[model samples]
Target chain A: MAKGGVAAERRRPHSHLREATVGYAFILPALVGIVALYLFPLIKTAYLSFTKTGVFGDSTFIGGANYANLVTDPTFGTALRSSAIYTVIVLLAIPISIVIAALIAQVRHGATLYRIAYFLPVVTLPVAVGMVWRFIYNGDFGLLNALLSLIGIDGKAWVADPTVAIFAVSAVGIWTSLGTAIIILGAGLQGIPQDLYEAASLDGAGPLRQFRSITLPLLTPSIFFVSVLSVIGSLQMFDLIYVMIGRNNPALSQSQTIVYLFYQKAFVEGNRGYGAAIAIALLLIIMALTAIQFRLQKRWVFYG
Target chain B: MGNTQPRHHQIIIHAVLGIGAVIMVAPFIWQILTTFKTVTESRAVPPTILPAVWSIAAYERFFTSVPLWSLLGMSLGVLVVRVGGQLVLCSLAAYGFARFRFPGRGLLFGVFLVMLMAPSQLFLISQFDLMKSLHLLDTLPAIAIPGMFSAFGTFLMRQAFIAIPKEFEEAARLDGANSWQLFWRILLPMTGPTLAALGVLTSLYSWNDLLWPLIVASNKHMTLPVGLSLLQGQYGTDYPTLMAGSLIASLPLIIVFVILQRQFFAGIASSGLKG
Candidate 1:
């Protein structure tokens, strides 16, 4: 291309030829990295899902056996259900975070402090975060039970009980993600012109009316961004659950996500082909959900 | 909207925010206090907020049981390389996308955006296989190589470069500066905030990453989070010792966050807005 560009430049006297050569050179590293790591692996995963992998990682074409097994597997059903429940439940963080962002934006003092405090969870290692929360949820001598006792209420083992374990973990999800949602929404809030609010006030709009009319509409873009990311992150949830609910936990079967199942099948059981199929399933799910969100965005995501 | 609230409203806001702040920070405080307690004290009913007799036994046990310093060294090594690679590669790619008019530019950029949207788990099996084929499994490079380049980083840097006026580049070109010269001397220096933000984000991700490292390394090569996970599995109910290990593992990143809080927040906010 550079050689052709040099030859063309002599006849056309165009600077674009030189710039294009430089541009290609500049992007070469990134292009190579992306293709080698991302694109190839993506295609390879898709291909591997159709085969059976041996103990030594040698694969043979198995047709639809893996997918057939995935559909019939009870564990896969539980993982899918848990993933859906976890994703839906964790989205509660969005509205709560929006309220926090609004409150922080309204206050004249200590905004930075609030942001720092809330963001602490986001920056901490998930393993560490899970461990700390696990200690707090311990049934025998947990902080949650102690706190409940102070209010004259009984608290069962939060993460040990399958019925409440997913919800308990989802609550931690909300706590950890609240900081990020707030920061994004806070930036969105700042983007809204104050004159709009002042104008609304002159026409007798109260805080609630002003918020409903102006803030919610203008903030929809950030809200959409946060919600989409939250959903994706929740669907792929593994680190927190793996650490908080151990392999022996009674709730493990009920609360394990698709990724956790993938890890178990691929690494623990050495079923690489089956794991690849699960990963592809997750990828397709993510794409479909993301596509649906994009399709629905036009209805509610206010561009202006 | 700043300082426009009535006095009574201000009080209400402060009260609500204060309570929220306490809830947010309570875990870290609990972890620290737990680190100093005895195992028996940690398991005491009504779980004492402060130990009756503070002890250093947990810390001693943690250090002796785990290769703490080596794990930290491994994590830091990965972080430095990952951050440095992303800074250079992402900036170069972003500059190319922002400044040049080339065939397939739109197509390549679209590819980057799609890559960003796809979950990292999609690449897990193949990435592991790649590492295995290259004989790089259970090594630091296996852990760091895949993370060294990021679609999100490229997109971010491209946006930052695009935000810069074209006039500067045109002026530099007229002054006989080449593309590399202009990028190095003019545009790069001016992108201090953007670079800092990227650096903070890349470092945070590399330091806190668990899954990739867990899959790629074991024992001696393990990074902090992976090593800490092993510690949890081995020590099961030793809450005090586990908390000690957790606190020690998290301290460096917390310190980095404290020092670069503004850049961290700005990076996350901008990514959300532009993404």
Candidate 2:
């Protein structure tokens, strides 16, 4: 469409110049924002990563010192592990969400209600979601414990216990993301030709058999998309952990992800250099993982 | 066999989804209930599902104690600038990319795509420095500036504009309409669904945004999320007040989602899978 428009405009050279000028004028603001806020900072982060931050947030070039520190830092290792675990745990939502989407698809009525109910967490502010969950996880008055006690079991301080805090936070990550995954998978399910299922039923295929043969194979593209996004989003988990687990919590160290670590180092401690390095590392990890997903997608994703 | 089995399947599906819905919405229901309960009842042993004596004291305290109104005002101001700016600017840029043969259009659009993948946190330190140098830190503009233009919005609009049949624009041009006139009169008015989708998503993002506003604004200038986070920090043990504050903070977006639920879901699905 655009090429045709351009080709026609090219017939009038003078008018073409005016059109190009208008084009530049139109894109100027977005261009400025992209350059100033995105491109420049991206480059600056790379540069800042090699420097040593001063007390006043100024940096002096220190030549891979921050990278070295990050490499040997036990805390960085722990954060890396926590983030990986969290990402994996959150990725579990993909299959769970697929099941829910499939179930909702099976129903003849009230699909909209199921979608809305699952999606409440997606729309609610993460801070609010975190707060509400925090109340539910409270050691004293938490609903989780209250329910557990009824079953002849006891509950610990879920978010405060170091061993379980990361898992607790990851559970929230899954719950919040389930809605988006369901919606994406539900759309994919809708796109499957109805006759394919009818044919399967004619062949005397059971529901589970039809799902395994028809649904899973056809739904790979959406699955790939949701998994890639969920991984990226999970790797960048900050607001939920920051709000739910909090700074003073005993499990803060164990629950902190890479982005949370970056926030603390750069913003709280004013160690801009180290923080920039962590952010860059995270950027590379996300890019690498996403690239891998895209490459691996060829094996599983059925474009048809 | 088929008919009876399917009825059984229907019952099982309804039972599963009904139970799942309860688990999903339980916290929200609890949050609402806790907002009206007194501190004592809110922390009652075994956790009372309903408040014995319903009172609005938590809401009253939240309003009186915190600068909830000003925080809301600041949040609204940021929302208007961010959403309005994104609509106008992203639409114009999308138009340019879609219809104009600029020299670096592909390259520039590529940069936008790259930025979409790069997390926003990478820019925090440098953007903060830029804000400080420009004297925007601790101000509403500071919160709004970086978010005013979104590459995602531009991309969505570009797709919308590209889907428009070229004949419409060709006819407009033949009628002696200039590029701006063509865009404003012909193309812009036709992208209602795309515009609505982008608007709803952008507002949802701006309303729920925490990290940027938390870092940029302080005290009276903080947005609702930042303010509510602070409330949690200060009143860590005050369940009722915190619940009340959180409810107030999240109510607007929830209401918006309820009203425009289809657009909201469409926006999420399209953005997630397509790009």
DockQ scores of the candidates: 0.68, 0.65
Tens digits of per-residue lDDT, candidate 2, A113-158, equal 9999999898898899999999999888899999999998889999
lDDT minimum window of 10 residues, candidate 1 chain B: B266-275
- lDDT of all predictions: 0.89, 0.89
> What is candidate 1's CA lDDT for residue A151?
96
Residue A220 lDDT, candidate 1, scale 0-100: 99
Compose the digit string of candidate 2's lDDT tens values, residues B1-275. 12324577899999999998999999999999999999999999977888999999999988887997889999999999998999999999999999888688899999999888888889988998898889888899999988887888899999999999999988877889988898998899999889988887888889888888988886558999998999887888888999999888888888888888999888887777221
Distance from true position, residue B177, model 2, in Å? 1.4
Task: Report, for all candidates in order, the number of backbone clashes.
Answer: 0, 0
For B1-275, candidate 1 gives per-residue lDDT tens digits of: 53465799888888988999999999899999998999999999978778999899999999999998889999999999899999999999999999888889999989888889888888888888889999998888999998888899998888889889989989988999998998889998878888888888888889988888888797469999999999998999999999999988988998888888899898888775221
- On DockQ, the leading prediction is 1
**lDDT for residue A198 in candidate 1, whole number 0-100:** 88
TM-score of chain A of each: 0.94, 0.93
